[model samples]
Target chain A: MNDFEYLEPATVAEACAMLKRYGGEARPYAGGAYLSIVMKQGLIRPKALVNIKKIQELKGIRFDPSEGFVIGALATHRELETSQLIREKLPILCAVEREVANIRVRNVGTVGGNLASGEPLTDLAQVFLALDARVAISGPSGDRTIPLEELFVDLYQTSLGEEEILTRVIVPPPPPATGIEYIRFSSSSVVDKPCVGVAVRISLNADRKTCGTVRIALGCVAPRPMRAQGAEALLTGHPLSPQLVEQAAAAAAEECSPISDLRGSERFKRGIVRVLVRRAMAVAYDRASHASTLRLRSGQAGSA
Target chain B: MKKQIRLRVNGMDRTVEVAPRTSLLEAVRDQLGLTGAKLGCDMQVCGACTLLLDGKPVSACSFLAVDADGSELTTIEGLAAGDRLHPLQEAFMDCGALQCGYCTSGFILTAKALLDEQPRPSEEQIKDYLGGNFCRCGCYQEIIQAVKKVAGI
Candidate 1:
């Protein structure tokens, strides 16, 4: 890695000021996993690294009766994998974290760093989108909160301002009779970057026969992880059936723009997306219908 | 520019001066002269540079040396007490788990972290934790046997 001045900021305000002072010549450094690789490869050369690990405000996992789960930006993947509250409440997150990279990477890679990196071949953003999460940002202008869906603007890019820092992720609790599932596909080894990832969230209508709300978030299939709105529209307010799921899956495949790569061809990725979308939506719906993960709570579903 | 940072490495508190670009693997092998943690994949994917950072396995190759400040770190050299080998190290020897020995330190350290968390992890759990560490010599079956022996599962 190229030599750079390391600046440690003790608070969100301080970090923002430091970034603003350095402007484009500085980058916020956290988790080390993402930045070190890129820096070593000479992909980016920042004159100074504003290390945000010391910012106490950006650390811990908190849950409230009304606020759902608030995850600290600096919290590591391993922490999420073993967090008692996440395990009990959002167990799907724990399952997904287990499959992210390896034990060493997960031990130090932060959730916020993963999302903020906007790396298309990732797991958390789509899953968080399915759970209807929001991000809290601190920057030179002021503090602002935005839905997670708005964060990703493109591959390796986010809507975050130059001086903004993602401080925490707010995950609204899944309402009663809501089920979530994420299926990750790799064309080669299990540890390879995802070829296609599908995250599905479904809420059952009373009488448990119709799908009241549906989210089909996909990753590694476009410039950024995106919602399969066409597929979701086909299923929402409808009683999910084998034929309907097939149609929705096919629709999801059509909506995504996958490019041919070493992992798989564009054609193969669409096929994987179709199969995974069908399976993930089916499983999520089944879970919702069974109410196996129901935790009674009141909150509006996040907009797509 | 160089910055001074203190780390409790293998039970010894020592201060090392490093540049912001210096990785923990370089500091341990060059500054502290603890060469047990091999530098295999410069990227974080391979586990050849695994070190226990505050009791959790992390890739020293990718982890910043500056980040180790005020934290407890364990390298392969710390596993033994005096002349007695750590149980995991002894198990690897008894099971003939290592052929090339390049990835042994990483595997043993990672296994130590796993056994610390889950004393008697099932076979599946064992595989999940150790799956990331590559044994290019293909000593995986024996490596698993060594870990199971230590766990007594």
Candidate 2:
């Protein structure tokens, strides 16, 4: 850790002003888990750190069945994992959150910091991208919402400006009778770097035998989280037959451009993507089929 | 540049002047002369530097000393009361949960947080909660047993 001035800004306005005053010389600190490690590695060297943990505007989790879910920037992974609304509304997110490092890392790792770092291996990126989540960023000019896909321009790079602060993430609630699944293949026992991770959200029809709409996002198999548009198109408005699911999985694997890295070979990642996509789709379909049954049972219990 | 930071460590409030980049672990061990919080990997990978920041477990090695201004912190030293050892500490000893004892403090603090939140956590949940803190001595079986015994499960 190099010597740098630390300014604890109480408000987002003050923090933004400090960033504007210092420009690129200052960096905002959230959890400081990744930033500290990166600074030690000489990847980044800022003259000042704008501590934003005290900013009340950047914390909390709010969910509205009509308006969607809004998670504040400073909300930790542990917060999300334990959130009752998150567990009920988006259980797939809980599955991914549980796999992120561990309890200690999750306790301090914030959602905004994780996404702002734009790490390819981050689980939130793929999960949010699949859900069509939007990021709320506050810059000197003002605040703006950027879709998750547009936020990540490349590895370790995002559309965030030097003076900008990511405030919140807005994820629209999935439609009724919708289900989601996240699947990943880790290189090591502890899931350091994922070989390939897939997120699938699908809505089933009234009969619960056909898909109404589908969204599929793949991570660690591309420069940024990429949507398997062709695979999704094949699944949407079609019955999720075993043959169609296999074909969609193959299409997803064919569309990805994975590289041989320390995690796995390009071919190995492609294979994992194929298998994971199929498995995720199966689980998602099952959830979609049972959504009505689960809803009715819960409603009846509440009334009773 | 050295800045003045006031931190309440264990149960005492102490003010110290240190370099801006000095880690909390170094401040507690070197400056304040409290060596209970061990420094393993200077990075956040190892849980040897785990401590309570406002009742939450965090890697003190990754935390800056200046960040502790007006904050409450607790180390392994504070777990005991007077001359008596804490229940977890005693349980660790009774169950022989430590071999070499290098990672004991971090593990103890982490387990303290877990047992505080969940008085009786399942065996699998205990494993998940302690996933980040590593013990090379492979005394996890005994540690789990000790925690369970303390929880009266």
Best by lDDT: 1
lDDT, model 2, position A142:
90
Give the 10-residue window scoring lowest on summed lDDT in candidate 1 chain A: A295-304
Give me candidate 1's TM-score against the actual structure.
Answer: 0.97
| Cα-based lDDT for every prediction | 0.89, 0.84
Runs in model 1 deviating more than 4 A are A296-304
Residue A225 Cα positional deviation in candidate 1, in Å, after optimal superposition: 0.7
lDDT of 1 by residue, A1-304 (tens): 7889899999889999999998878899899889889999999999999999988989899896777799999999989988988887888888788888898888889998999988999788888988989999989899999999899999899999889999999999887789788888888877778888889999888868888889999999999989999999999889999999999999999999999999899999999999998888878887888785455221111111
DockQ of each: 0.89, 0.69
Candidate 2: where are CA atoms >4 Å away?
Answer: A64-66, A191-193, A205-207, A293-304
Model 2 quality (TM-score): 0.94
Clashing pairs in 1: none
